[model samples]
Target: MIPVNEPLLNGNESKYLLECIETGWISSEGPFITRFEREFAATVGRKHAIAVANGSMALDAGMMALGLEEGAEVIMPSFTIISCAAAIVRAGCVPVAVDSDALTWNIDPTKIEAAITPKTRAIMVVHIYGLPCDMTAINEIARRHDLKIIEDAAEMHGQTYNGQPCGSFGDVSIFSFYPNKHITTGEGGMIVTDSDALADRSRSLRNLCFLPARRFVHEELGWNMRMTNMQAALGCAQLERLPEFVERKRAMGKLYTELLQDLPGIQLPLPETSYARNIYWVYGIVLKDEIDFDAAEAMKRLAAKGIGCRPFFWPMHEQPVLQKMGFFKDADLPIAAKLARRGFYIPSGMALREDQIREVAGMVAEVIR
Candidate 1:
């Protein structure tokens, strides 16, 4: 069966990994970690970048760096991965979620103002599936309310919004280097910021909050979420090829759109918007209401045809874990719910070839027909 996702590691990845092994700097304290952080920060136009064990930990560190008061509310999209909401809840802040836009499949900026309350301390805008949220509008709202912005740019490595990079807009932004992501370091994440204090605090938080002068003593609680030298080595290699990866993804998206543009009973992802072009991190398709089956059945049929597919994230409002905590109780977000049930993405990995894409598209057409 064709895989749903495959990373393209045809760069300096092996050379760097070998160098790390040869130098015996395979741990988190190696020079590669610092080098990777510096380069990544420059790449994103941020003053600082802190590498962590994984993307989830990056969110956790970023939320902690905010130093929000207990029960402070953070507004975010309900259509995002659990990590976004989990970080807020773990940081002792209440996560208030809004619905997603039907067109962009991103957080609806129009709904953000209504979700904001007196206790709201931050607005975490997740750049979902390589499509940026309306940051121009979101930033305006944040400025009016004095709320901090946390950008989850995990799916938008090289994506931009109105000429500005996604990570540059947030007070503390994050990216993941998971295998399925545009860049891969096996498992790694980064938190970038312009504020010196936030950067220092994020570093401390990820490293057990040990005082700079004293190694053993600690002033506050923190976690060991450091990214290893080996991981950073891989990241450096991946970073070098990010631009090319993004272009390849865009081309793949165009190819898919071209192949399936006239297919019935499906809503394809938009290729471009006025704010920014969709990077097509994954080529998602939302089955129309006229379709008889949900994404699960569609995925099953695709798999049978040797075409790999993955479903979109389940909305946070429907999660039993959050429901038990009384979050989003009685809240009805129709767009997120419908998309969750009907949306699934075909093979759009960077490593995917033209033939593979055509095969996948043909199989999807057959299955849907």
Candidate 2:
């Protein structure tokens, strides 16, 4: 089967990892961790960056570092991964979700104000797929309301909005280095910010709140979410090749669009918006109403034809875990609900070859034909 994603590791990933093993500096205390954090922060135009075990943990750390009051409402998109909402909940805050823009698939900036109340303290902007949310508009809203912005740029490693970087917009922004991301450390994440206090708090939280002056004494509870030195080694190597990797992703997106443009009954990812071109983190296809099957059935058929597929995120409001919590009382996010039911992405990884793209395109057409 043609796998949905296969990361390309042609750079110095193995060489850096060998150095880590040879020097016996495989733990989080090694030099590569600091180097990686510094370089990554510079790349994203942030004052500081804290490395964590994974993207979810980075979100947890980022949210806690905000130090919002208990029960403070954080406005976010209903169409994001559960991690976005889970972090807010873990930090003792309520997530007031807004619907996605029908075209952009990012948070609807227009719907944001309606969800804001006196309890609202932050807006968590999650850039979806490869496109960024309307930061110009979102920033204006946050400025007027005096709300903090927490950007999730996991799917956007080398992407920019207008001319500025995606992770540079919010007060505290995050990036995930999962295997499928533009750059990967196997599994890792980062928290970046311009605020010194926020950076210090995030570092303390990731390391279990151990006071620097009093090593073992802890004043506040925090998680052990530090990324390993080996992961940082890999991250440093991957980060070197980020520019090329981004080009590869964009090239892959273009080829897929060219091949699948003739196919009916499905909608392709938008190549570019007014502000920025899509990096195409994953090439997603949403079935039109004429297609009588849901994404689950589409995946099954694709699997039967020796092609791998993955579904879009299930909306937060429809989650059984949150439903049990009595959230989303009579929610009405139709676009998100429909996208979840009909959307799935085919193979679009750095390792994918031109012939494989052709094959996948053919199989997709056959499945929907």
Candidate 3:
């Protein structure tokens, strides 16, 4: 089967891992952790980078470091993963949902101001799929309102926005290093920022908020979300090949576009926006409104043909857990809801070859058309 994603680990991954084992420095306190954090910070143009256990923990640590007042609202894309809202809620804040752009599929900046209120403290800018949210407009809104920006760059590892790196936009930005991502640590994440205070706070939050002077005494609660040296070793190796991996993804994207550009009953991902070219984090396909079936049915058909696929994020406004919490009761994000129902992505991993891209594209065409 042509799986949705498979990590490419042809770099010095094995060598670094063997070094970690040979040196018996496999714990979180090992040297590779610091080296990974430092190199990642430099790559993302951040002053500091705090390594964490995973993406969800990165979000949790990042939100806690913000220290926002309870009940303050955070405006975010409803099309994003539930982790964004969960992090805000866990940090004692409310998440305000916004619709996505029809073309770009990122959060609609035009709808943001309408969601802002007196209690609004931040805008959680989630760079969805391949392209980034329009940072130029979002930055303007945040500046005018004096709101904090938390950039979720989970899917955009090597992406930039208008010549600036994506993870450098917000007060705190996060990345996930899952195997499906451009870079992989097997399971890891990083929180990066220019503020020393935020960086220190994130580090403390990832390590259970231990006091520097005291060993077992903690003034505030935090999580044990530290990344191990072994994971950092893998991360360092993956980081070395991020640029090459990005090019490969783009090459696959270009091939898919060529193969299925004219396929009926589907909307292809836009290759580029005015600000930035798509990095094609995943080769997302949105079934046109005229299509008889939803993404779920389409995915089933693709699977029958040995083409593995995955559905898009369900809108946060429609989440059952959030519904139970009495949030987004009156939300009306039509675009996000429609995308959730119709969108799914095919094979677009780092290890995907040109032949697999053609086969997936051909199968998608046969299934959807």
Candidate 4:
């Protein structure tokens, strides 16, 4: 069966990993960590980048660095991964969620203002499926309310918004180097920021808040969320080939669009918009309301045909864990709920070839028909 996702590691991945092993710098304290952080920060146009164990930890660190008070509300999209909300809740802040835009599949900026209350301290803008959130409008709102912005650029590595990089817009931003992301380090994450204090605090937070002068002593609580040197080595290699990877993704997106443009009973992912181009992190399609089946049935059929597909994120408001915690007591987001039930993405991995894409498209057409 064709895999839903496959990472391309043909660059200096092996060479870097070999170097790390040969130099005996496989741990988190190796030079590759510093080198990767420096290069990644420069690439993202950030003053500082703190490497972490994983993307979830990056969010946790970002929330900590913001110094949000307990019970402070952070406005974010309900359509995002659980990590976004988990970080806010773990940081002792309340995550106030808004629904996603039907077009861009990103957080609806118009709904943000309504979600904001006196207790709201930050706006977490998660660039969904490689499409950037409406940063201009969101930034304007943030400026008006004096709220901080935390950008989750995990799905968008080389994507831009109105000519500005996604990571550059937030007070603090994060990227994941999970295997499925544009870049891969097996498991790694980064926190990028322009604020010196945030950067320092983030570093401290990732390293157990151990004071530099005192080896084992700590002033506050923190975690051992450091990225290994081997992981950083892989990340450095991946970073070098980012431009190539981005172009490949665009080509794949275009191919999918062309192949499935006229397919019936489904809404395809959007192309370029005025604000940002759709990088098609994965080529998702939402079954029309008239369709007889939801994404689960569609995915089952696809898998039966030896084609791989994954469903969209279930809205946070609908999650059992969150619901059991007495959260979202009065929340209702129809758009996110509909998309969750109907949306699923076909194979759009970097390693996917044109023939495989055509095959997947053909299979999808057959199933839908």
| Model 4, runs deviating above 4 Å | none
What tens-digit string does per-residue lDDT give for candidate 2 at 13-86? 99999999999999988999999999999999999999999999999999999999999999999998999999
Q: What lDDT tens digits, residue by residue, belong to model 1 across residues 211-248?
A: 98999898789999999999999999999998999899
Q: Measured by C-alpha RMSD in angstroms, how accurate is candidate 2?
A: 0.7
Per-candidate TM equals 0.99, 0.99, 0.99, 0.99
Worst 10 residues of 2 by lDDT: 95-104
* Backbone clashes in model 4, listed as residue pairs: none
- Candidate 4 residue lDDT tens string, 49-73: 9999999999999998999999999
lDDT for model 1, please: 0.94
Clashes of 3: 0
Q: Select the stronger candidate by lDDT from 1 and 4.
A: 1
Per-residue lDDT tens digits for candidate 3, residues 202-259, read: 9899888899999689999999999999999999999998888888888888889999
List the candidate 3 regions with Cα displacement exceeding 4 Å.
none
Report the C-alpha displacement of residue 163, candidate 4, in angstroms: 1.2
Per-residue error (Å), model 4, residue 310? 0.9
